[model samples]
Target: MIVLLNLGFTITSTSQAADKIAIVDISSIFQQLPQRETVAKKLEDEFKKRATELQSMERDLKIKMQQLQLNGSNMEPDARISLEKSLIAQRDNLSTKAHAFEQDNRRRQTEERDKILNCIQEAVRIVATKKNYDIVINANAIAYANNAKDITNDVLKQVK
Candidate 1:
């Protein structure tokens, strides 16, 4: 019984000595960063022209489609066939452009997100080092963390 008591004491002391835990909400940090807004603005400005052009093309495609549908029954066979072919070609072009725009937008967003993530990591590292944190975990993975142990605000301040 004495040996078992000693073992329990040792385990408890070891755990106490090793408990230097902190939690941060990385998503909250990311969203709270001013850099996120800058990146979003840059992406919007970069893609604005292409997005506008795509919109214009879509409008044109819609108008042409309506015209075809409305006039198809009254038009001569050859004329109707020609107009249909033109509409098909325009639709294909619009589809291709729209797909390319979407891909480019996604890539740019991913790049910006990565850059912000790197910044957040650096901020966390700085805060952790300064506060002498032995282990910092994302709060998202924890069911509950004491507000005292949550360093998200500290990390955000450092990041900002």
Candidate 2:
């Protein structure tokens, strides 16, 4: 009987020492971050010139295509062939530039997103350490948690 009582006490103490867990809504925090908007604006500004140039090229190509359709039948065979080759080359150039622009934009967005996520992670770590939390879990991974255990706001404050 005494041995069983001692075992029960040990179990109780172990349960009492359970780790302090906290939850954070990473997506919510990410959305609310000012850095996200700033990065978006920066990327927009960086790519705006390229986007405008692509639009201009597209417009020019459309105009040339229209002109060819209207006048190709009346033009000399060699001149028509030359104009067709030129349009094809222009289209290929525009396609290449547009593809490169898209790749660059995506790369920059990924880089900025990684930086922002790292910032959020650091903030979560700081909040968790300062608040004596033993574990910090992403809110999305869990089905349910009490509001009191949510440290998302604290993390956001730390980040900002």
Candidate 3:
């Protein structure tokens, strides 16, 4: 009975060892993807116009402020009050627009990042499936793994 039990244990261990496992560095894969740069450039281009407009508004505000400081004493009281109110309104408008711009840019960046991540995941799945991997793990989640089991390059190739 002891001999049979030992034989069964050996079989179980052997079968467990036979499982095909692979590790992938997802961050490395993401950084190496050529599409990453393309996406960044696209985002930059998309936001460039808004950024330029904001800068122009800022310059105009600064000039107005300087003019007020330089000529406030010479201006009629009513005219000075009116200029002050206009500056305040312009400043508030610029602030609101700038805040919205930042939020929109962040949202777009996150959207783009998620899309790239999805692409990477699909590539990993394809490589794992084609190579008959029973388990695939992210390198970041583990303490250490043999370099031989790393299938990052294969996934990168698939993604590219």
Model 2 per-residue lDDT tens digits across residues 58-157: 9999999999999999999999999999999999999999999999999999999999999999999999999898889999998876553889999999
User: TM-scores of the models, in the given order?
Assistant: 0.89, 0.87, 0.85
**Cα lDDT of model 1 by residue, 1-160, tens digit:** 9999999999998676446678889999898888888999999999999999999999998998898899999999999999999989999999999999999999999998998888889988898898888888998887875543788999999888
Residue pairs clashing, model 1: none
Indicate the residue-level lDDT of 8 in model 3.
Answer: 100
- Local distance difference test, each candidate: 0.89, 0.92, 0.93
Number of clashing residue pairs, candidate 1: 0
Compute the lDDT of residue 143 as modeled in candidate 2.
83
Ranking of all predicted structures according to lDDT, beginning with the best and ending with the worst: 3, 2, 1
What is the Å distance of residue 86 in model 1 from its true position? 1.3
Question: What TM-score should be assigned to candidate 2?
Answer: 0.87
- Assess the local accuracy of residue 23 in candidate 3 as a C-alpha lDDT between 0 and 100: 90
On lDDT, the stronger of 1 and 2 is: 2
Clashes of each: 0, 0, 0
Best by TM-score: 1
For every candidate, C-alpha RMSD to the true structure in Å? 2.0, 2.6, 2.7
lDDT for model 3: 0.93
